[model samples]
Target chain A: MILKRVFLNRLSGTWMLITLVIILSLPLVIGIALYLKASPIFESQSLYQLIVSTDWSPCNGNFGFWPFIFSSLYVTVLSFLFAAPICLFAAIYLTQFSSKRLIQLMHPVIDILAGIPSVIYGMWGIIIIVPFVSDVLAPLINIKSSGYSILAGGIVLAVMCIPYMLNMLIETFNTVPIGLKEASLSLGATSWESVKHVVIKKSYPGIISSFGLGIAKAFGETLAVMMVVGNMVQLSFNPFEAGYPLPALIANNYGEMLSIPMYDSALMFAAFILLVVVLVINLVFRYFIHKTQSQ
Target chain B: MNKQKEIEELFFKFLSGFATYSLIAILGFIIIIIFVKGFGALSLDMIIKTPKGGYYYGGEGGVLNAIVGSLYIAFGATFIAILIGIPAALYINVHLVRYKRIQNTIRYFLDALWGIPSIVYGAFGFTLMLFLGMNASLLAGIITVAFLITPIIIRTFDEVLSTIPKGLHEASLALGSTRTEMAFKVMFKQGFSGFITAVLLAFGRGIGDAASILFTAGYTDLIPTHLDEPAATLPLAIFFQLSSPIPEVRERAYAAAAILTIIILIISLTARGFSKKYSKSNLK
Candidate 1:
C-alpha cells in the first residue's frame, strides 16, 4: 500500500509538471504556428514592401498591409486619446474623492461594462454612435461621412476601454499608501494637491501600464471595430474616413480566403501582426511594471 | 492666490465627477438601449424555436440553434478549462510551493497567454483545424474557446488559491498527506466556491466571445447534435442578424444581444456573490 501510494504521488507530480510545461509553451506554440501560416506571404513579398505598400488586390495576388496597419494605429491612438483622460479623471474621482459606498457601487457597474460582449458594443455603436457621428458630428464639422467611420469605431472602442482602464487606474490609485496622501494633506496642501502630487505620482507606473494594456486591447479589437470601421482599405489619416484595421481585415476576409490564392496567407499575416503587436505591448508594460515594483 | 488654488481644486473635482458620471451614464445607456429595443422583438417563440426558412430575410423563427449551441460550447469549454486549470493551479500552489522562480515564470507565461486576443486564438485554431484535417464544428469551437478561457480560469483560480494562508500548506503536509492529496482534498475543498466562481467567469467569457469562434465554429441553423457539426453562437448570431438589411432580423439581433447580456450579467453577479460569501469562510 505504501509503495502504491508513493507511485501514485509520483505519477500525479509528473502529470502536473507536464501540464505546466504545456501551458508555459502555449504562447510560443501559437507564435510559431502563426509564423508558419503567414510565411507564404513573407516569401512572396519583401517585408518592407508588404508593410509599406498600399496595394491590397488579392485577385492578382498583391498584398500590402500599410493601410490596415495605419488604420489600426490611428484607431487605437484615437481611442486612447478619447478614453485616457476620462478614465484617469473618473478613476481619481472614484478612488480619491468618493466615499467607500460609491466605490463599492461602481464596482459592479464597471464589471458589467467590461463583461458586455464586443458584439453588443458593436450593435450599440451602429445604433447610436454611427447616426450621431454622420448626422450630427460630421455635419457640425462640415464633413460628409457614411456613418461608418474610424471616428465611430474610436468612440465605441473608447467606451469599451473605459471600464478596463478605469478598473486598473482605480486599483493603482488605491495602492498608494494612505499615509503618503495624509502626509501631503497635513503639509498644508489641499486634497486635490495631495492627490495630484502624491497619489498620481506614486501610481504613475501603474497608470502607464494600464494605458498600455488598454491600448493593446484596443489595437486588437475585431468585431466591434469591424462592424463600424466600414472595412474600407485606404491610406487615410482622416478619423471620419472609413478604414480597415488589421483584425477587421482578417475577420472580414477569412471566409473568402480559401477561394483566392495568397488570400489566406495575407489574412494569416494580418493575424500574426496583431498577435506580435499585442504581445510586444504587453511585454513592455509588464516589464515596466515589474521594474517599478521591484524598486 | 490661496482662493485661486481652492477654486481650481473644486473645478477639477467637478470635472472628475463629470467624467465619472458620464461613464455611469454610458453603462446605463447600453443597458437601456439593449433592453428597450430587444423587448419589442423578444418572445417565447424567439427563445424556443430554431430559425426557419428565410429567417435571415425576416422570416418567422427564433435563434434557438445559436442559444443551445452557445451553451454547449461554453459548457464544454468550461469543463475542459476546469479539468486543466484546477490541476495546474493546484500544482503551482502546492507541488511547487518552494520554487518561487518557476512559479513566477509559469505565471508570466500565463499572463502573456491571457493578453493574447481571442482573434489570434481563432486564427490559431483555424490553422490547427487545417493541420488536423478537421472542419469547423462544435468540438473545434469548444477546443478553441478552451484555449481562450483556460488562462483566465487558471489565473482566477491561482489568485483564489494564493489567498489561502501559507500555514495550510505546511499544516497539511505535517499531517503526512501527500502533495496531491493535500491539493485535491484540502486546498480544493477550501477553495471550492472560488473554483465555481472561476469556472462561471470563464464560462461567461467563453459564451460571449465571438472572435475566437468566428471561423472555427461554423454557423448553422440547426442545433448541433454531433461534436463535428457546425454550431451557431449568440454573439455571431447577433453579428450576422444585425447586419441583415431586414428590420425584423435586426430587431432579433438586439433581442439576442439582450439575451447574451443578461446571461453574462447573471454569471458575473453570481460569481461576485459566491466570492463574497466564501471569502469569509476561508482560513486567513
Candidate 2:
C-alpha cells in the first residue's frame, strides 16, 4: 500500500511538472514562432528601410511601416495623457479620502468596464465618439475631419484603459503603510500633503509600473481602436487625421495576405513588433516591481 | 502662506472627486447606451433562430449561430485552460513551496504572458495553423484562446492557493501523507471555491475576447457542428454586423453587444458571489 501511494505521488508530480514546463516556455515559443514567420520580409528589405519608409503600396511590393508605427504611438501617447491624470487622482481619492463602502461600490463598476468586450467598445465609439468628434470637436477646433481620427480613438482607448490603470494605482496606494501616513500627519501635514509626500513618494515605483502597464495595453488594443482610428495609412502628426495603427494594419489585412507576395510576412512582422514591444514593456515594469518588493 | 496651502488642497480634492464621478458616469453611460439601443432590436426570434439569407443586408434570422458558437468556443477553451492551469498553479504553490525564487520567476513569466495582446496571439495562431497544414476552425480557435486565458487562470488560482496557511501543509505531511496527496487532497479542498472563481473569471475573459480568435476561428453564419468546422463568435458577429452600412444590421450589432455584456456580467457577478461566500465561510 505504501509503495502504491509513493508511485501515485510520483505520477502526479511528474504530470504537474510537465505543465509547469509548458507554462514557463510559452512566451518564448510564441516569440520564436512570430520571429521565424516574419523573417521572410527581412530577405526583401532591410529592417530599417521597412520601418522608416513612408510608401505602403502592398501591390507594388513596397511595405513601409512608418505610418502605422507613428499612428500607434500618437494614439497611445494621447490616450495616456487623457487617462493618467484622471486615474491617478481617482485612485488617490479612493484610497485616501473615500470610505471603504464607497471603494466596495466602485469594484463592480470597474469590473464591468473591464469586462466589456473591446468590440463593444468599438461599436460604442462608432455610434457616439466618431460623430461627436466629426461634428462637434473638429468644427470647434477648426479642423476638417471624418470623425475617425486619432482623437476619437484616443478618447475611446482612454476610457477602456481607465479601469485597468485605476485598479493598479489603487492597489499600489493601498500598499503604502498606514504608519507612514500617520507619521506625516503627526508632523502637522495636511491630508493632501501627506498623500503627496508620504503615500506618493513611497508608491512611486508602483505608480510608474502601473502607467507602464497601461501604455502597453493601449499600444496593443486592436478592435476598438481599429474601428475608430480611420485605418488610413498615412504619416500624420495631426490628431484629427485618420491614421492606421500597427495592430489595425495586421487585423485589417491578414485575411487577404496570401494573395500578395510578402504580405503575410509583412503582417507577421507587424505582429512581431507588437509582441516584442509589449513584452519589453512588461519585463521592464516587472523588474521594477520585483526590485521594489524585494527591498 | 496657510491660505495658499488650503486653496491648493481644496482644488486637488475637488479634481479627484470630479475624476472619480466622471469614471462612474462613463460606466453608467456605456451600460445604458448598449441596453437602450439593443432593446429595440432584441427579440425572441433574434435569440432562437439562426440567420437566414440576407442577414447582413438586414433581411431575417438571428444571431443564434453566434450565440451558440461563442458558448462553444468559450466552454472548450475554458476547459482546456482549467486542465492545464490548475495543475500548474497547484505545482507552484504546493510541490514547489520550498523554492520561493522559482515560484516568483514563474509568476513573473505568467504576468508577461498575461500582458501579451490577443491580436498577437491571433497572428501567431494563424502562422501556426499554416505550418501545420490546418485551416481555421473551432479547434484552432479553442487552442488559441486556451493559450490566451491559461495564464489568467494559473495566476488567479496561484494567488488563492498562496493564501492557504502553511500550517495545514505541515499538518498534512505530519500525518504521513505524501506531498502529492497533501497537495491534491488537502490544499485542493481548501482552495476549491477560489479555484472555481478563477475558472469563472477565465471563462468570462475567454468569452468576451475577440482578437485572439479572429484569425484562427474563421467566421461562418452557421453554428459549428464539429471541431473542424468554422465558428462565429458574438464579438466577431457584432463587428461584422456593425461594420455593415445598413442601419438594420447595425442595430442588430448593438443587440449582440448587449447579449454579450449580459453574459459577461453574469459570469463576473457569479465569481464575486463565490469568492464572497468562500470568505464568509473562512470567517466562520
Candidate 3:
C-alpha cells in the first residue's frame, strides 16, 4: 500500500510537469518557427524593400507588404476613433452618475456584446451592414457602391471593440474612490467639472491601457475585417476602397497555397509580424496592470 | 439655491440617461442585426446537411458535422489545457520553482500566448503538423486550440488559487498534512468550482474561435468519425457560406451563426451562474 501511494504521488507530479511543458512549449515552438521562417525573407531581401513595395501579388515574385500594414493600421485607427470617445464618456457615466437600475441593465448588454462570436459579427456585417453602407453610406461619401470596404469593416470593428474598452474602463473608473468625487463636489466643483478634472484624470493611465487593449483587439481581428474589408491591395486613404490587412491576407490565402513554398513563407513572415505585434501589446497591458497595482 | 440644485440634478439625469441609452443601443443594434440575418437564413436542412463543392444549393445539407466538429475540438482542446494549465498555475504559485527567472519567462510567454493572433497559431500548428507528417488532423486542430487557450486557464486558475486564504494552507499543514496534501486537499479543494469555471471559459473561447482552425482543421465534408480525419467546424461553415454566391448557402450561414451565438451565450451564462453561486454560498 505504501509503494502504491508513492507511485500515485509521483504520477501526479509527472502529470503536472507534462501539462506545464505542453502549455508553455507549444507557443514557444511556434515563436521559434516564425523566427526561422522570417529571417531569410528579411535578411536576403532588405526589410525596407519587402515592406514598402506597393504591389503584393504573390503569384509573381513581388512580396510588398506596405498596403496590408497600412490597411491594418488605418482600420484600427478609424475604429478607435469611433469607439473611444463614446466608450470613455459611457465609462464615466456608468461609474459616476448612473443609478443601480441603469447599471444593472447596461452590464448584461455589454457582456452579451462581448460574448457574441466574431463570425456572427461577420455575418451581421455582410448581410445588413454591407448593404446599408453601399446604399446610404457610400452615396453620402460619393463613392461607387462596393459593400465590402474599409469603412464598413472599420465601423463593425469599432462596435465590436467598444464593449471591451467600456468594460475595462468602467472597472478602472469605479476603482477611483467615491470620497474624492464627493470632496471635489463639496468644494464648489460641478459634477461634470469634478469628473472631467479629477476622476477621469486619475484613471487616465488605466483608460489608455484599456484603449491600447482595444486597439490590439482591432489589430488582430480576423473574421469581421476579412469579410467586409473588400480584400483589396490598393494604398488609398479612401474608406470605400477594399483592403487587405495582415489577418485578412493570411486567412484568405493560406488554404490555396498548396505547392508554393515561397508564398507560404511570405505569409508565414506576415504571421510572425502579427504575433510580435500582439505580444508587444499584451506585454504592455500586463506592465500597465502591474504598474497600476504597484501604484 | 433650490432652483440651482434642481437644475443641476436635471442636467445630471439627462447626461446619464443619454449615455446609458446609447450604450444599450449599441448592444441592441448588434443583437437585432445578428438575429434578423440569422433568422432570415435559417432552414431545417442547415442543421443536418453536409457541404458539397460548387453551388452549396439545391441539396439537402446540415451543420451536424460542423457542430459536432466544433464541440470535439473545443472539448479536446480544453481537456488538454486543463490537464496542463491548472497544474502549471499551481506550480507557479505554490511550487516556487528554483529558477525564478525561467519560471517568470514561461509565465510571460503564456501571457504573450494569449495575445498571439489565432491565425499565427494556425500557421504554427500547420507547420508542427507538417513536421509530424500528420496533415490537417483533428488532433492538430485541438493542439492549436489548446495552445491558443492555455493562457486563459492559467490566468484564471492562478487568480482563483491565489485568492484562497493562506490560513487554510497553514491549518492544513498544522494538521500534519504534507505540502502536496495541503495543495490538493486544502487549497485546490476550495478552488474547484473556480477551476471548472476557468475551464469552461476556455471551452467557450475555443469553440468561438474560427481562425485557428481555418488551416489546421482544413475542410472536410464528411463528419469526423475519428480524430485522424479533417473536420469542418461551424465557424468555417459560416465563413465559406457567407462568401458563396448561392442564396441557399447564405441562409445556412445565418442559421450556423445563430447556433454558434446561442452556444456561446449558454457557455457564458453558465460560467456567470457558477461564479454567482459560489459567491452567494460563501457569503452565507
Number of clashes recorded per candidate: 0, 0, 4
Interface RMSD of 3: 2.9
Q: All models, DockQ values?
A: 0.76, 0.82, 0.52
Best by lDDT: 2
Off by over 4 Å in 2: none
> After TM-score superposition, what is the CA distance of residue A116 in candidate 2 from its true location, in Å?
0.8
lDDT of 3 by residue, B30-126 (tens): 6776677777867766676665444376467678889989999999999988877888887765555346566556666676677677888888888
- Displacement of residue B96 (Cα, Å) in model 2 is 1.4
Q: lDDT of model 1 at residue A254?
A: 80
Q: For model 1, what is the alpha-carbon lDDT of residue B180?
A: 81
Evaluate residue A68 in candidate 3 and report its C-alpha lDDT on the 0 to 100 scale.
Answer: 95
Model 3: per-residue Cα lDDT over A113-144, one tens digit each: 87777888887888778998899988886878
TM-scores of chain B, in order = 0.97, 0.97, 0.87
Tell me the lDDT of candidate 3: 0.80
Query: Clashing residue pairs, candidate 2?
Result: none
What is the DockQ score, from 0 to 1, of model 3? 0.52
Please give the lDDT score at residue A12 for candidate 1: 83
lDDT of 2: 0.91
lDDT of 1 at A24: 76
